[model samples]
Target: MSKLLEINNLCVDYVSPNGIARAVNNVSISIAEGETLGIAGESGCGKSTLAFAISRLHKAPALISEGEILYKGQDVLKMNDKALREFRWNEVSVVFQSAMNSLNPVITIGEQLTDVMLAHKKVTPKQAYEKAAELLQTVGIHPDRLSAFPHQLSGGMRQRVVIAVALALEPKLIIMDEPTTALDVVVEREILNELYDLKAKFGFSILFISHDLSLMGEIADRIGVMYAGNMIELGEAKTVFSEPQHPYTQGLISSFPTIHGPKERLYGIPGNPVNLLQIPQGCNFQARCSHCFEPCTEHEPVLKTIAPEHHVSCHLV
Candidate 1:
C-alpha cells in the first residue's frame, strides 16, 4: 500500500526551568493506507508528545525543535495557520484520552457534532445535524439521543460519541491516545471490536498510542516500542510479541499478564524513565535494563534491521 503519513527525525523540546527537555527525540515512523500502527511506552516516554507534534498541537512550553511531519507527501511542519486549521480535522484527527470530556457540557451532543461538520464541511446547521445523526448511528448510538447532554451518556457511550465525532470528517488517519483506558475491560473490548470493524469498513489508518502492550497487540498490524523518547524497537506485531529484540521491549512484555493462562506474576520495569532535561550519557533505558552491558552505558545504539520489517536499537540485540 502507498504511504499516507511519514514522520522524519521528529524532535519536540521544552524550555523548562532547569534546561531544555527533549520530549520527542529524533523519532521517525510511517503508516501506509489502511494500516494500524501501535506506539507502546510508559508515561513520559514521549509517546503522547509525538502525537502532539504530528498534529501540530504542541504549545509554547512544548515545541517541535526539529523534524518534519509529512502527511500525504505534504510537509505538515510548513503548513500555514489557515492550512493547518483545515488539515487538522479534515485529514488527520485525534481522539484524545477521556475524550468523553471533549464534549461541551453546555451544548447538546447534536450541536457539538454539528459544529465540527459546519466548520470543516462548510455545511448549514440543518445539514450538519443530519450528518451528526448519521454519524451517531454509524458508531452504534441512537440518533434519538442526539439531543441528550454530555453528562447524560455513559462513559462508553461518551467515548463512542467521540469516535463518531472523529469520523464526522472521515479522516484518513486517526491518532488515538489511550482511547479505552478509562473504561471497564468489557467495555474496552467492545470499543476495540467496534474500532476494528470500522477500520475494516472505512480503510482508514490509525496511530494507536497506549501503555497497554497486550491490548495493542490485539489491534495493531505493527508495533513500535519507545523508551525515553527513543524508538527502541519496531516490527510486525507477531514478531515483536514472540521475539522482542530490544531489552526494554522484552521487559515491557514481561510486565503484562498473558491471556488464557493461570495468574502468573507480572514484573515491572525497574527504575523510572529518564528525565529529558537530565538525560543519561548513553542508552536512556540502560539504567533500568537488566541486560545492559558496559557498552550500553557509554554509547547510544542506533536502529538496525534485525529481520524483514523489524528494527531494534539495542547493542545487545
Candidate 2:
C-alpha cells in the first residue's frame, strides 16, 4: 500500500501563563492509502492534540513546537494560509470528538453541509444543495432531514450529518477523533458500520482516534498505543491485542473485557496519567509499569522494530 500520511518526530505544545504543556512528544506514525489506523489512549494523552496538529487546526497558545506532518509528501507544517485552507477539507477532513454536538444549532443540516462545499468553492449553490442531499442519503440519513435544524434531529442523526459533512469533498484522509464517543453502544456500532461502508465506497483512509481499545480492534488495520503523549506500541491490531509487547499495552488490553474468551479479572493500570507539563525523565510508563527495570527509570527508550511491522518503545522490549 502507498503511504498517505506520515508524521515524524511530531511535537505539539500548549503554551500559556501556566507553562508549556507538551501534548505530543516525538510521536511518529503513518497511514497507508485506504487504510484505517487507530490510536488508543486515555484522556489527556495527546490523541486529540495530534489530530488538531495534523489538520493545522491548533489555535494560538497551542502550537506545533516541532514536527513534520507530511500528507502525500507535502509538508503540512509549512503550508501558508491559502494553501492550508485548500489542503484542509479538500484532501483531509476532521470529524472532531463529540462532533455530533459540533453541528451549528442555528443552521439547517443542509446549510451546514453545503457551506463546507461553498467555502472551498467546490460547487455552486445549486450543486452544493444537490450534493448535500446525496451525502445525507449516503450516510443512511433521509434527504428531507437536511432542511431540519440540529435540535430537531436525534443524536445519531446529528452524528451522521457531521460524518456527511466530512465526506462532502470525498477527502483522501479523515481524522475521526472519537467520532462516536457520545453515542450508545448500539448507535456507536451502527455508526461504525456506516463508517466502514462509507470508507469502502469512498476509498478514503481513516485515522480513528479513541480511548476504546476493543473498538479500535474492530475497525483499524493497525493500532498504536499512546501513553503520556508517547506512542508506546505500534503493530497490526491483532498482534497488538493478542501479543502486546509494551507493559502499558498489556494493561490496556487487560482492562477491556473480551466477549469471545473466558471471563478474567479487569486489571486496570495503576497511577494517574503523567502530567504533560512536568513529564518525568525516562519511560513515562515506568512509574505505572509492573515490569519496571533499572534502565526503565534511567533512560528513555526509542521506538524500535522488534518484528515485522511491529514496533515498541520500552527498555524491557
Candidate 3:
C-alpha cells in the first residue's frame, strides 16, 4: 500500500499558567492510501491532540513542539498560510468530535455545504447547490432537506450532513476525531456502515480516533494504542485484539467485553493515566502495568517490531 499520511516523532504541547503539558510525545504513525487507521486511548491520552496536529489545526496554548507531518510527500508542518488554506479540505478534511452539533443552527444545510465548495473554488454557485443536494443524498439524507435549518434535522441526520460537507471537495484523506461520540450504539453503527460504503465508493483513506476498542476493531484496518502521549502498540486490528504484546495494550483489551464470546467481568486497568505536566521517567505506563520490572522504571522503551507489521513499546515485549 502507498503512504498517504506519515507522522514522524510528532510532539504537541499545551501551555498554561501552571506548566506546559506534553499532550503528544514523539508519536509516529501512518495511514496508507484507501486504508483505515484507528487510534484508541482514554480521554486524556492525546488522541485528539494528535488528530488536530495532523490537520495543523492546533491553536491558542497548544503548540507543535517537534517533528514532521508529511502528506503525500509534502511537508505539512511547513506549509505557508495560502498553501495551508488550499491544502485543507482539498487534500485532507476533518470530521470533529460531536460534529453533528457543529452545524450552524441558523444557516440552511445547503448553504453550509455550498460554502465549502465555494470557498475552495471547486464549483460555481449554481453548481455548488447542485453538488450540495447530491451530497445530502449521498449520505442518505433527502435532497429537499438542504433548505432546512440544522435544528430541523435529527442528530444522526446532522452528523451525516457534517460528513457530507467534509466530502464536498472530495479530500483524499479524512481525519475522523471520535465522529460518533454523541450518538447511540445503533445510530453509531448505522453511521459507520454508511461511512464504510462511502469510503469504498470514493476511495478516500480514513484516520479514525476513538476510545472504543471494539468499534475500532470493527472498522479499522490497523489499530494503534496510545497511553500518556506514547504509542504503545501498533498492529493489525485482529492481531492486537487477540495477541497484544504491550502490557498496557493487554490491559486495554481486557477492559472491553466481546459480543460472541462468553460473558466475563470487565477488568479495568489500574491507576489513572499519567499526568502530562509531570510524566514519570522510563515507561509511561509503568505505574499501571502488571509486568513492570526494574528496567521498566529506569529506561524508556522504543517501538520494536514483534511480528509482521506489529510493533510494541515495552521492555517486556
All candidates: CA RMSD (Å): 1.2, 1.2, 1.1
Candidate 3 lDDT: 0.92
Better candidate by TM-score, 1 or 3: 3
Give the winner by lDDT: 1 or 2.
2
How would the candidate models be sorted by lDDT, starting from the highest? 3, 2, 1
lDDT by residue (12-78, candidate 1, tens digit) is 8988789898888889899999999999999888888888888998788998888888889999989
Model 1 reaches what TM-score against the true structure?
A: 0.97
CA lDDT scores, all candidates in order: 0.90, 0.92, 0.92
Superposed model 3: Cα runs more than 4 Å off: none
Which is the winner by lDDT between candidate 1 and candidate 3? 3
Runs with alpha carbons beyond 4 Å of true place in candidate 1:
261-263
| Regions more than 4 Å wrong, model 2 | none
Candidate ordering by TM-score (highest first): 3, 2, 1
Alpha-carbon shift of residue 299 in model 3 (angstroms): 1.0
How close is every model to the real structure, measured as TM-score? Answer: 0.97, 0.97, 0.98
lDDT by residue for model 2 over 269-311, one digit each (tens)? 8999987777777888888988988888889899999999999
Error of 1 at 184 (Å): 0.8
